[model samples]
Target: MRDDNASPDEPGTSTDRSGLSRRSFLTAAAALGLLPAGGRAFAEDKLLTFEKPRAFSFDLLADQARRMAMQPYIETKSRDPKVLDQIDFDAHWKIKYRPEATLEVADGSAPVRLFHLGRYFQLPVGIHVVDGDKSRELRYDPVVFEMPEDSPARKLPKDIGYAGLRVMAPDQKTDWLAFLGAAYFRSAGELNQYGLSARALAIDVAMPTPEEFPRFTDYYLERSTTPGHELVITCLIDSPRMTGVFRMDVGKHGPVVMDIDSRFFARDKIDRVGLAPLTSMFWFSETDRPDRIDWRPEVHDSDGLALWTGSNERIWRPLNNPPMVRTSSFADRGPKGFGLLQRDRSFANYQDDGVFYEKRPTVWIEPKGDWGAGEVQLVEIPTDDEIHDNIVVYWVSEKPVGRGDEIPLSYRLTWSKDEPHPAEVSTVTATRIGRGGIPGQPRPKGVMKFAIDFDGGYVAKLDRDAKGVEAVVNASRGELSNIECYSVKIGTAWRMTFDIKADDPEPVDLRAYLKSGDQTLTETWLYQFLPEPDSAA
Candidate 1:
């Protein structure tokens, strides 16, 4: 590791660091009594105001959460909701955190910044700076933020606290990591584009009962002493049903990786609890591109859910823009890993350039220890527009959670262009559904055609003339026919075509794979097809 005490003029010290290494700089500052022990850091830095130092640690935070669960839960409220209501999306974006106020923490590294509260995000979240075991809370003041004279944010009180915080790139331009909304946080992964968000915890999600959103009410940030890890974040979450703590060690590699240690305590029994939940938008892709809804060829942050099972099997389940709410669960003993991936990288596929959907990062979750028996649950809610987040995936324990339950889990989140695991078998590249019968022929009623593409594994090297390539197919409610698989010829990709004859109102579970003799050549492609009315079957 580089010397933390190195001077700005030091040969190896980068200019962007501004001579301040977050860990050492803050440590040295606190030693000098930068501000009165309890008052604020504002005297030293106008952007920050701090409270007195308090002893803190990961275990302490978890213990506090457990204690909080034993007591009654209280909901967080805004100091002035009426004023915040005037600051809508347009007004919020107009308020910017001044560059001079950037918080320090990177390899000596990235600068950290604060976010302002607004209409959509009104609940104040306490932000703190941690130096060793002592942490100081940063008080909110309008001096750190800039806005126009007429901006409604100016009417907000000084102690409104921050809505969230983000870590900026060395260039002081783009933010690589951000914590915002409820328990939501996201990383601008390999491509440096923001997309999906991961939650600290999900309670009773996608159930008949209203989903509970646990708020990350407080944050403790410290510059990591570890070589690659840049920032350490501790979040205290509170909800009506539970209280929890999430400790994250965040770092940037080829992918942005967050090693998270989560502890949740329940005050009452939860019908369902989702761990490591990922949220994103999946309006429409090639599989079911509804006309008039969007002019873009495809629109979605992620198109498929990829899973690595404990049995050493791989499965690729394409996402769908269902007509109704859909929840699918894949059971497992100990899941190896899973993620929502945007495999289609071509810019032409997305068309519109404002927010590059093609560049949206893929987030994979790898359990650090045995997760035991659980299932990867995917809940896709119907959406007619791209504005709403409609896709959610998380791990749900087979064991039930009840009152006074304290659950601990650890996992690593990799935000990247692709999953961290090496691909040894061909993966589903594309999935398209359309009218069943052969093109130019009379379309068969109650029959839908399914075409899937696979590339980049054993199938790529297989002989084009190999007749042994069998398109093994199965469906829960329909007969599959016209099955065929062949090399596409342009790339290593191969295509599988088939038809499913299903008229049932329920979704049809279809599974398909390719193999030559005893060896499986591709990951299992599972599709939950929601049937449509058809005159012919």
Candidate 2:
């Protein structure tokens, strides 16, 4: 993982790239104020310098991406890696942008701040401000940044360039959104706590071959003219395998929302192209509490993947921390939307009050146009600690992508405490796993119990002692037993508990839902159970 200098004292964590750790991403700009007390205005010295203006447009950027795809890829290199490498976490934080030097777009509609290049982010990304049909590149100079007396960043060259950028709040102490290493970006959503990261695109993810991380090489920031929209961010992303242009219309009304338009040009055949990908952390929740060694009862940014299929079926798949890397694909056509949700907002679930996991935002992906024939893919990588981001979910179109292909996908991402649209059917509240057989009897070996809860919608109004409730269940490779459905003694929610004897060493895919006679009472619950030898069954 690669992230540099993101302080642990910060509110949210960022997923690391090659040189950075997962916790190093967001802390740089999430809550820290760049300026020291009473830092004077640098406007008198023309702090925000710029190069000559050049005509720019999303269409032009997309066309350029297509042309770039036709030619061999040229990678960007750091001007002085040795010096940058010395700018580690502490030193990098010392070099902060001066508040007075912040760039104001369209007469201060949005304020933009620059990030200094550091060890993890050695290669510089161009920063530009767009006005009308023309855009001007911001000049990088030591004058804009405040460095300590002996900061390592002082050794860098004058034109070493910027690493990334963030959109600042009016207070300037905290940032609402930030674009950092690789193609990753994160927004401090309605809760003002950063948890997950969203990427422009993902290539060859979870494949046998190593994954490729494309970089956003340049950015064009502009003020949004729309009433609700605050900023317009356009970027040019490049890699050996693909090139693309993404335009994001971002607004911070309650929940942070970004309306994104991505145009990609494939330079080579892609086995899997993940569109609108979201990267998160799911270490151990109530579902895997028995496997956890940490003191916290639960720890995760998201607990489940909520999907609305093209066939009008709503599914809730609880996230798992598998024994190995697990990739689950749900096939559909003209899909509606999908998102990773953090339903449990109770602070007691995660006792570590430092990071406030309870306030982490749930990000939902909403497709703009018809995304025909695709699979919502969830790739979970095993992690023992919360420092690593191990969960990634995205929409991958079934259509094979080859060189010389031009594709355009548009979607909106909403980061909040709940989904943009709540489920019409009762939604899953919690999932727990433990011993399979009865408590007083000898527990069956190779068997595991699954306890799932669902509340709201049609199920909420039903009687707690309803006699005809049924659990529609299915297992890919297991003998299911102890199937039962009843009302919980705690809340208005209904509970569905069952046990499956999965002898196979491989994972068992299971599905169940609460139903009354012929009518479905809750959204379908899907899970993958990994068997553990010599454990309670």
Error of 2 at 447 (Å): 2.3
Clashing residue pairs found in predicted model 2: 1-17, 1-20, 2-16, 2-17, 2-19, 2-20, 3-20, 3-21, 16-22, 436-537
Over the stretch 204-260, how does candidate 1's per-residue lDDT look in tens digits? 777776677788999987777667887888999999999999999988967998899
Give the per-residue lDDT of model 2 (tens digit) for 21-104.
Answer: 233453335222221111221222466667888888999989889999999999887788888878876666656666767766
Model 1: ten consecutive residues of lowest lDDT: 24-33
How big is the RMSD of model 2? 3.6
Q: Model 2 lDDT vs. the true structure?
A: 0.79
| TM-score, one value per model | 0.90, 0.93
Q: Once model 2 is optimally superposed onto the true structure by TM-score, how far is the C-alpha of residue 252 displaced, in angstroms?
A: 0.7
